[model samples]
Target: MILIESEFPIDWVISPLPEEEGILGNIFFISRDYMQFIEGLVKKYKPDFVVEDKGMRSNEEILSDEDEFTAIFKRGGISYRMVDIPEYALNYISSPILNKKALIKKFSGEIEEYKRRGQVHYNDPHFQQLVMWYEYLKEDLKAQEEELRYKIRESWMMMGILELAKKQQKKELTAFFICDKRNFDGIVFLANELDITSEIINIKKVAKELEEKNSVEEVIKSSVLEIMPIKMKKKEKIDKILYFFDTDEYCSPFDTNMGYDAGFDVVIPYCKMTAERVAKLIQDAMFSRKVGAPTVFFVGGSDVEESERIAQEVLKSMVPPFEYPIIIDPRGAHTTASAIVAKTLEIAKKHGIKDLSNKKVVCLGGTGPVGEIAAIIASKLNANVFITSRREEYVKDLAKSLTIKAGKKAKKIEGVAANSDEDYYEIIKDADIIWSVGKAGIQMVSKEIMNKLPKNKIVVDINLVPPYGVEGIEPNFHDEEFYPGIYGIGALDIGRLKYKVESTLFNKASMTKGKTILDYNVAFEIATEVLFGEIIKISI
Candidate 1:
């Protein structure tokens, strides 16, 4: 005989029974879908008699009218019976033999203990209620009640089956015992105790197996190839890996964390990397992977020139199909600069300044990596850009180099010295956009100088530390008027956009199927899209 088990409402163990002893609890109604499932099983097994848990009985006291389970058997001309513990025995077991209040308090303490031990699922509403009832029954009623309620009922059901088997003059009788999942183990143990042979069938597992078998059969029937007995080859697995190369002595935690968050399966970091060593690492990584497997390279460090060199080396080392996507954002300069320019342009357009073309733009302390990239981006937009530093000669030479990189033959960028407040005032007097991309904690423009600047100008500061690069602009201000007509964008506002730009680049590099070089140009494009919902392309 096969046995079927289902989940039980644990609360019923501690709840009061209905007034009529023969009438089962009203909480035991089966859905139409599950009734059909049980009917299918009954038809397949073709049992002479069907025995169900007492809770499945209808309230009708007459034998002519049947419950849902009894009706299923009656339609097939089969006999049916319901089994449960006797009313007198139930009343004797449920008597006040133990302290119920103390048991509840103990259960509450156990719940707190489970929470403290990090078993947090006990705090869920359904689980909490289930545990409350189950624990209460186990503690208050003791072992005798449990045996009477579960074991005795199951034994009576088995006796009924044996009596039917003998009446029908059959040597083997097949029965299906649909009991609660909580009492499944107890029921099986009792069957072994009485030496009754039975098989357990998990309905859900059997249904899943049948579904999979049907799917395979359908595929075989629709196949073009001739059916034959052969073992199918297993498909190989490929992992997406990112090779992160940092020029510094150690890899930066910020970049590695972003790489993992961007969905790379594995990230291998190499610190103190040089261009000479990058070729061998790339070759080793690419040669071992299958074709079409995602592999990416990331170049990062404080030294922008060294990072660029390493990136170029990585590209050179790869053969045609093995070449992978690479992201280059040294010291976050590329993305930061992109964010700065994109934000400036976004604010500029709002103020009726359609574009950066022919606008006078000044970059304070602009000889640094971030300032240098920002200066180039402004120049590429056809703006007349000026980069400043304390050292005049160094700033001028760097400006000349950046002018060539910006692809401007007319030399739209120039360098100036800003060693004093007068220098800052004179330089930014007619500027349409003033950016303070200086070293942290260094005040590039004092409040007096900011007040002296022209009205209707856009100002930005990238120094989060105080005294800030621009004296009056707060780090979190975005498009706020610090002075009468001067709109100021602060360091923290720019930083938020910079983070989005960098993350998008990393995710794209990880997902690309072919070779992609993510540099300042791509960073600027992504920044524009992220900030304004559309790409604003600069045609240089």
Candidate 2:
């Protein structure tokens, strides 16, 4: 789990014992004001152990930018001992004030700077008044800084002492709440996020209780946040996914929502993501996790090759033992291909064709992403696959590339040109499955060609626009025996399963362990399992 503590609102102040001697007017817990911002970061970043400490050093104001000061951790990198702050637990408790001498020594420069910028002339009474005001503010800031430092030291020592106590007594950090203010919404929100009982104990009460406790063990056992994340459940994983879509537009709500529906606890979508950006994102996601992390990656967009390149970069970013599964579905092609091939198998089985091994499958528009993937999956079923294009050279090149990608299944598939009517007739003459993967409204296989083609065969047209990709099958048909003895599955039929298949794969990405890539073959397996195989529950 990665924890990203958002920017601390450094303006929040609490006046405790206003007339108290030595210490400053109010305790400054500048980091505690952003309850909502912190919560949002916690959810979005999915951090395991949050570090909301404002160490006494004023590092947030000086060493880092406001955004940079807000902590961002990759998964499994939550041990933030580098901060070296007191364990800030009970509602923004800071240190006691410094002496007047220390305040002057600490902020003399600041006081002078204020005097230099004052409104009146140096000799004027108003200038004197302005100088006095600067002195007052400087002293106040110095005192607050010292007091915050004291609390920080106390917290650090308390944490060390308490951890030793826990080891000695075997007590859990979950057993305590060390807070100063009970009714503050910010306090309550933090308390709840930490999964503690919001008992509303103020820091003052907590401090008093600490003083009364005789043993160091007793003091730490009762402090929340300060005790460190004790006994975090090693099991029971919550999955998160980073989805990078490379397009001018950020991302469609459809896919992102689908990720959530598929069981991801949080789905962070990034748009217009480049290969370089994806590399960094991959590094962050993978490096943030330890063993059995539920975080994963999803790559998608309209540009097929670019998305593929980014996905490849993501895969390459992971070294052995520290990697997450990635799914590549450019323009919904992977899921679409899975559905198209799965439907063909379904239709074949209905006609008493149990095995697809002997089937002759021909895919029109073979050069396209959808067609190529469909050809690959169908070939995996041992079907004799042939991809056709108007250009013989293009068909051959697509077939070669698809062949390389499909590996052993390459032997079962080939490509040919089907530019003319005679070519289409000859191609579909012995085809058991004819898929029109051409662009929408461009009819490849017409009614006449279907009439001449062999019967008891399946024809699938995944084009919603008219003139349909395939000549005879209706664009709106889900599954109608539009042509006798030949079952035609339309675009909508494949589309429905396409959505289901993608969600199923996402669920698999979250749940599946070890090294696994969810692509067309995996998608097909999941789709078939959902429809016909053992009753696997698919959420969407």
Q: Which candidate's lDDT is highest?
A: 1
Q: Worst ten-residue run, lDDT, model 1?
A: 225-234
lDDT of 2 by residue, 449-475 (tens): 777765787889989988897777875
lDDT of each prediction vs. the true structure? 0.78, 0.64
What are the candidates' C-alpha RMSDs?
Answer: 18.8, 21.9
Top candidate when judged by TM-score against the true structure: 1
Q: Which stretches of candidate 1 lie over 4 Å from their true place?
A: 1-237, 408-411
Question: Candidate 2: worst 10 consecutive residues by lDDT?
Answer: 174-183
Residue 375 alpha-carbon offset, candidate 1, angstroms? 1.2
Q: Give the C-alpha lDDT of model 2.
A: 0.64
Residues 1-540, model 1: lDDT tens digits: 556654333223534556575344454555454567678778778886666566434336325464565688789877666655555655665555335545666777776777698876945895578587858666655665566556766676666556666676666667766666555566666666666665665544212223333476765555333212122222343667989899999999998988888878798999999999988888899999987798889999888879989988988898988878899988888999999999999999899999888999999999888998899888888889999999989999989989988884434689998889999999999999999998999998889988777799999999988998888999898999999899999999999999999999988887787777888888999999997888876546
Query: What are the runs in model 2 whose C-alpha is more than 4 Å off?
Result: 1-239, 247-252, 272-276, 288-293, 475-479, 534-540
